[model samples]
Target chain A: MSALKRVQQWATFARVWHIYDASWQNPFKSAELLKKYLMGLHKPIYHPMNDCGDHVIVINSGDIALPGDEWKRRVYFHHTGYPGGATWTLAWELHSKDPTMVLRKAVYNSMDGNLQRRYTMERLHLFPDANVPTNLLKNVSNQIQQLKAKPKRLDHYSENQVKQFPKIFDYPKDYILK
Target chain B: MLLNMNMIVPLGILRNVLFQSKFPIRSMRIFPRLQLKEIREVQNEKELVIYGEIVPSERANILLKNTHPQACPLCASGLDVKHTDILIISQFVRSDGCMLPRRITGLCRTQQKRMSSLVTMAQKAGLMPNLNPANSKKDPKKRFQWKKFNKYFDESTIKS
Candidate 1:
């Protein structure tokens, strides 16, 4: 093929990739990997003080999973300051009442307090249902088939990965590896 | 002894043992000891209801912001509204108990003072009932006796 034809084909593939839902189960890992893969953070224009990353559209929020009793025990309290003003509601109750609110609140809380944080927040588009337009990537038959299977969801680790989690010991001696 | 001239009893008097106890029940005071009385008994209905009058949220918000009993005295910042801060304005009771300081309600000092004054004002205005008569304070011994009665009834029900 001529060099001009090859360049045109590559450009078409790039456009298709831009519209694809390269879905990942683990959002943290997905974001981190995509940051490097897409050269979002390494660009000469990259600034730590500013949020300059591309937008990430998250769908199927109802299918998102949490591993522990966080859904039930977590409580949010507020009051109107009148007779019987104070009230308590749980995370599960909030989720059931409004699923989109749950995800939005979670992501917003996860962000730092700054102008950049606001920018990061604006980039996140969350849909409680499968409402996103992924038609651009639909033409890529192989990619679509792979995405149909559950995206390998990433878990955000606060300290370390769960797989290498150290077992709790009542005594210091018990933690010694044989 | 009944026939003794010196031992004459009053014409209409009947000696009852129930009323002869060393600790006679004290009568409840009419004022200072604010107790919740029946609404029908209260002559003024206008003083009772604070809601349904469309009081602006800004007013409540302002009161909460400025004079909340739980706020800090030094700063306008939030502080805990302790049990001590809880003003129990009983209608007839002179002494109102305050709630203890707690971790929640981060009331600043100025707010607490403001709130305390507001509560006192509320009590004086008779807007808030000082106490409920049904929940009036009782002697611990009497409470224990009531518990005993409860236990007896519970046992009887079990037997049946």
Candidate 2:
């Protein structure tokens, strides 16, 4: 192979490490996106028989947000083969026990239930907070963008900025401000 | 004429009532209320004085001006305000984070309902923690059970 062709082949076949911020994001939605990368769906040479796949490091999994009342409404079911062993856990209850478990299960469940699923999950790394290990941090060369914009808090703005924002409606003349 | 000087009526409404009577509407005069003033009360040694001061609203000079006689101020401005926009939502809120009454806000019935809903969403999202209830948690990040996490609202979910 020519020098340029050899470098191109090495680049396409090499594993790429991607970092994703899970703070304030919906876990189910993030899982779909992460599953594609974990299964090497983005690679041009992706095939069912190919072993090539990318590694995804997700941080702030503890901060995943559920839509509306899903925290209490959604339930995870489990059974241990015995008739009385069946149990259901609320989303929040499960999250309270392990913050990273929710996101880990989300990405795991997003993929097909084939035998290779467990092997594919081995490449996924989840951290409850932003503190990723130095070894894992060094491998991330790409970042996946967050699905939603972080909402700004009113107290985060300077006093001047709030006062300078345009007024929409004025209070009545007789109104007293506390 | 049946005179009740204590009654403070608008000129247009007074004219409509007087048009059917012998009182000459042309002879009447109008003292318009101050558009921008703050009323304050002072207790003197022997008496009380209640007066208004010309106090302009902050940023009044550069506010988005609007004029649509048939529509409310918000509707006339044509602003598609969302729940995440705390700046516009704060205008319709009191110091205690309560929604101002319809009469005070001067918003149409539909807009009033929507604005109140937006206000609720903003509070739920913890965007305006400073104006929340005194007994409530001041830090949104420290809220109880399931609420401490950051959550957002979709404006479409509002019924209006």
Candidate 3:
């Protein structure tokens, strides 16, 4: 192959790294999107056993959102294989212990129940915060869109923005403001 | 003698009692001040604290035009209000992050309940940190443990 053509081939064949912001995203939904890239399902020559050169870097995994009270409601079950060794941990507790654990498990549970699942998970890199290493970050060429829009806090708005917003109703003339 | 009495010096106690009954309206105002009182450590007397309210002319001139006159303000506008809609939710909240009572908001029964719940949800999510109490940590990220993380609410999960 010509020198230019060889370089082009390498560029096309090299692994395409994708970065996804886990902030305010449901990890389960994100896992579905990441699964395609990890397994090369989106490629034309995709096979169940085939390996693809794709890396998904999920940042702010600690900020992944759970739908309503799920943090306290959802429980993770574990056992040591000894009699009376069973233990259950709430989602919040687990997240507090390891910020990335919730998203990691969510992504893991979302995949197929087979040995290949473990291998596929290796391609997924989860970060608790937005501190991805420079080497891995440089390779990222694509960003996966979050399913849900990130929520903005009231305090985030500027004072002028809040003040300029239309008033809902004027307080009664007789009523006193606190 | 009558002409001389017209310019006569009025006694402090007699003049006070004379104007007190005639001009009671002067003592009471249209918009009464807050009735909050404080007892200072230095003095035993209770001090009446008068707070200033925003003048009508100085208020936000830009008000949402309510199209529906019959229906409630929220019901009139067919907006799918979400908890994340802090702009809309903040309108129903007080300076201290408390939801305004239905009487003041003038929302219908359903809207009032829904908005209050949405307000609660937003507050718990630390979305209205600025409107919180004086002792609050203004930054949501500075909250304890899991609370410091970014979390969103499912409106459907809210019980009416």
The positional error of residue A97 in candidate 3, measured at the CA in angstroms, is: 1.3
Alpha-carbon lDDT, every model = 0.36, 0.82, 0.76
All candidates in order of lDDT, best leading: 2, 3, 1
Runs in model 3 deviating more than 4 A are A1-13, B1-54, B57-60, B141-148
Clashes of each: 48, 0, 1
Docking class of 1: incorrect
* Order of quality (DockQ): 3, 2, 1
**Which regions of candidate 2 are displaced past 4 Å?**
B1-54, B67-69
Best by TM-score: 2
Ranking by TM-score: 2, 3, 1
TM-score of each: 0.30, 0.83, 0.79
Instruction: Please give the RMSD of candidate 1 to the true structure.
Output: 26.6
User: Could you tell me how far off, in angstroms, the CA of residue B117 lies in candidate 1 after the best superposition?
Assistant: 58
For B27-116, candidate 1 gives per-residue lDDT tens digits of: 423222221221112223333221111112211222323443433422433343221222221111222323213222233444434444
- Residue B72, candidate 3: Cα error in Å is 1.4
lDDT of 3 by residue, A20-133 (tens): 898888877887888888877887667776666388999998888877667787899999999999999988899889989988888788878998888888999989989989
Error of 2 at B123 (Å): 1.5
